[model samples]
Target: MAEVEAADFETAIAECGFGLFNVFILISSVPCLTAMVFSAATLSYVMPSAECDLKLSLLDRGMLNAATYAGMIFSAIPWGFIADTMGRRVVLICGGWLDGFFVLCAAFSQDFLQLMVFKFIDGLIICGPFAVVVSYLAEFHGKKHRAYVMLFVGLSVSVGAMILPLMAYCLLPVHIFFNVGQLQFHTWQIFIAITSLPSLLSGFLHMFLPESPKFLMSQGNYNKALISLQRIYALNNRKSRDSYPVKKLTDATPDRSDVINNPNPRRSRQERYKLAKKKFCDGLMQLRPMCSSPFLGLSIQVYCLHFCQIMCVNSVRLWLPQIFATMHTFRIRGMNDTSMCAVMDHNTHGRPIDTKSMEEECDIHQDPDMYIDNIVVAAVGLAGFILIFPFLRIAIVANHILKVFLFLSTFLVGGLYFSKTTLTTLILSSIYLTMMGVCATTIISMSVVIFPTLMRTMVLLLIMTFGRLGSVVGNVLLPIFMQISCIAPFLWLCTLMTIAFTISLFLKVDVQQSLN
Candidate 1:
């Protein structure tokens, strides 16, 4: 095995310049991650309508919310290995198209079983695109620009969360009813379709993308790595390919051939099976080193911190809209989104709410105002991420800063449900939401800065995977617990977040060294 140094690769990438190339990738990958957000959070758009027609129980709706993540909880780590084996491009292309197809199928599902199946497949397929984007973007830039790239992508995700309901606001109210045999076309269907387009479109667009240079280098394709870097340099600097800088990387760079992608052209089925078994065994052996001795402790620490962080942050992201909507019913002046959807729902049955009332007791009204509020709060959160990025040049400061914000946000939210007036609750909620973006950016930045290059991709994927697991558990229990008491869900959030905060107290990472 030959060496491929990070500094050498980093220098070649840095010569590519952080202009048009990084901007293009940063823009394209946004929709991929945001589509994952839609997949996990689509229940927000669907529940209000499902409450009208599907006649779903509160628990049933919660299951639907968790369905995609149910798939995610099990799929991500395996997908990480696949990404390492088959290459990022294949995963993104296949996963992107499959996710859209599954989501589209889910939109047409006539029963709970069908919807869950399709949504699970959607989650299964999406893990690739979402997880690969982290590594893909990192491979495109030098370390100096990597944090900015992640922050920008995070900002895009925040914007996506903000715009989802606004888009739902515009499209979900349309009374566009038509039929294709057993299928009915309506707002939720339309919203699902619109959200699915980005993934489908991006997937096809990705067909034209090159494999990650770092992945190529890992595969011992130094020529291909050089070509990829040269291409990026030309695009970013608006120069001819021949004129790009950084002709070659150092020959003495580290050899990471253990995880490199290699495919044989002609092999028997039995031979392939044996090869896979051997590779799997070998990969397990490789992982054992990281899980034992000195690296073992840090590995466990990072995963636990990640698990706890995801448990708290994802819970908040997944349920933000519903929590806001539930809070809306307490409003004396605003009409809930239920009333807004009345016009669309009544088109099917002359009286939709009347029919739904016979099935289950409905209490809180869905307010579209909360959509606007989410968008505004999300914008504020985006600002928080941007505000924190510069300070993140100091890695220790980043983690500590996040801890302080987490403490404050928890306090605001824990007191929110106990507020004396609706106004006080609203104020607390706004500040709580504002703090979310800051917390999110910090988590990602710390992970990127602190983890080693060899382990970075796997760690990020685990963070995302466990984050989905958190969402699955949180959404499932949120409505059930909220039914018990107004403060019950927040208390749950506070406990998980406090646990995350406490975990951070003991877990240690070489944040300053990784950055330097």
Candidate 2:
């Protein structure tokens, strides 16, 4: 027999080059942008001036705020298992449109119960795509660039924040009204419809995009994986199949821990059944290590890190818009009452009011910069993404920079709490968003390094599940804390994050392996 050398599948991908194929993969992951839409919807959906305000109390309001995330925490594990089984594309397509349908249903909801129910179901399935998109995009890249690719995909959070408020500003102020069969349509309802469009389009877009080549290889569909690689090569090189370089992909180093091996080409039906059973058993066996001993402690540490990151970030984020709204209201209140609009006189008299008779209690004119402020904060996060995401390429600094950023975040919370003016608050919040960009990206990058392919997505989901749980707690408690004092929520956040920072110092991540 002749001796031969095999190239790593990752090496083969690098040979194909990073061009249109990489850009295509980037576009494919854009659906992840919709991940924050449900949370942002609450910013616009339940506004005070909104015609159909639920008129909810503090606790009720908190629950409504957390409802989508509550559904996500519940569904995370099950959805991950499904993505690992039924295939990522199917789950994304179905989940994406289903989320759109339910969110659309929420727009017409008559009561808090209806809105909450629809929003919950929307999050239940939508989280499948949100949790898997990073892993999916990472898998498509060569190991040298995988972590950075995932980081770019994670920018969807900032993109969502920028988008939601811009759309709301345009639609919310318009007092459109119409009726059909006891259902009423208004500017708010129209806003929900527009926002849900992404959820509707994401699935359809995936219809054209190929599955992760790494996923195909994992499933023992080597030929299919090769075809995927060839397609990417063709797209990147602007050449046909004949010009594609690679004849076949070879796993130079096969993963011993992976339960599902390349399938036997010549197996009987009974043998296939036996293989399936063995694979299932192997998966359960593989999980034992992560769920126990040294790995178990690490898993707990990672979960807490992610939880704190989300809690600190979202606790401030979900409330920031409302805070801005309130600040503008106070500014208006302090201004001259001469600027007020005339109240309709329908209740007191069946005639129009004189110009001098305008009520002093008329609604304040909303600040023009409010939506722009949301975009600015989100853009600040993007700037952080640009600055920190690339640094992962430097193995030595990746771990150290993240730790330094984490420590700074604790102090940043104090800055946010004591910010007296809206300008100061915005500047502090923008800085916080930048930290969130670095901090949250670090968590995902760490996940990629810590776990192998077999359990990578599953473990990522577990981290996200814990993170969403923290978000739920923050949403539930922030309102209550605000009742006591303006600074209480940030103070409590600072205390919680101090514990997170201490734990992170002890975290022993393999940053070199993560960057590959």
Candidate 3:
């Protein structure tokens, strides 16, 4: 038998060429983005509303927030492992379907307990596609374009953040009734239900998309990898003149090559599985190595950076609606006094006035209906924010700058609340939208590029797991702050941002001009 040379991974990919489905990839990210916004917006504020509607204690509400991200933190790593072990396509599609189902479950929850259970499950299931899809996007692009495309993914998330609130704003205005009783549905419920549509679409689209060729190559399926590459080329509308070049695979010398003997290839599939398992075990056993000098220093650097970011964001997002609700109340009270004063002025000027009767007039402006109209505040803020992120970069230094901007806005919101001025509240809310959109994109985009390719998925899993844990704490921390004073949460956010800003200056390594 003649000896055959192995294929080259990189050259094979290069010759096969990049795909034109960058738009598809962008579209694919819509579900992940939309799901996060849907989950975050709903989970954050649902606590207060649950207290309002179902009359649950604040402790129970806090439990729900904790439960939701507990699910997220637990599910992220396992899903990443599955995506690596199985394939990205199947896991992504499942994520979409699960998202829609769980969201609907949340919408129909009869009580806080039911809502908590369903939401936790939804959090676990829906987030499978989140980091996995980002990993796929990274895998598809060449080194030169990786950051650029990931930026697009980041941008898509911002667009989702904008759109999610708008959808909630629209769905929240109407009332729904049932035979048992008139059940009033709020904007949050509607937001959760409608946001699931994007996930559904993503699930459908993933049916046609190819599996990751890189994954296939890792598994030692060169022919399968080639076929996957062909699909990618076709999707991109590039001519598949040559299959994913085999030469690069031979040159790169994938780990699987060692399993089959060139000089010592005799391992069976069982042995290879054992070897892979051993590597996984080794990674775990080397906990000390993971924290050793350079590794520990780098990990600490990224961890603190992400920790501060997530912690501040979690608290802010959870309390924003409550803050807005207070602002709306202030606005209504001001409008009422202003109207009353005008009426008194007119009566004093010889106009006919029934002062006793006027005092009996009911002001429905303070009612829940008032809340429906003001959903646009969140909607407008989100939309305006989505439009502003494309021109921004994921600079670490800028991350803190954005946080500072958010803090200043938070100060404005605090001031307005204290001073009881509606205009200041409105202005602060506008700035809040812009700051959130920018901060979100910057964090995700920057995180995606900073890690190396081999550890990319693992590192992302680590980032999200811990980052979201912080988010979970932040969400629950709302009630803790509320116990002291309403302003405490914002004050904490300000402090967290100040810390993050200091860290960003030293921690961020600019990867924009540098290629991996």
Q: Which number leads on lDDT? A: 2
With candidate 3 superimposed using the best TM-score fit, by how many Å does residue 307's alpha carbon deviate from the native?
1.8
TM-score of 2: 0.85
**Cα lDDT of all candidates, in order?**
0.67, 0.68, 0.59
lDDT of 2 by residue, 18-48 (tens): 8887886677667655644544345333453
Stretches of candidate 3 off by over 4 Å are 1-19, 43-52, 179-191, 218-221, 241-247, 250-293, 333-420, 513-516
Backbone collisions counted per model: 7, 0, 14
* Residue pairs clashing, model 2: none
* Selected candidate, larger lDDT, 1 vs 2: 2
Give the CA lDDT, 0 to 100, for residue 142 in model 1.
75
Whole-structure CA lDDT of model 2: 0.68
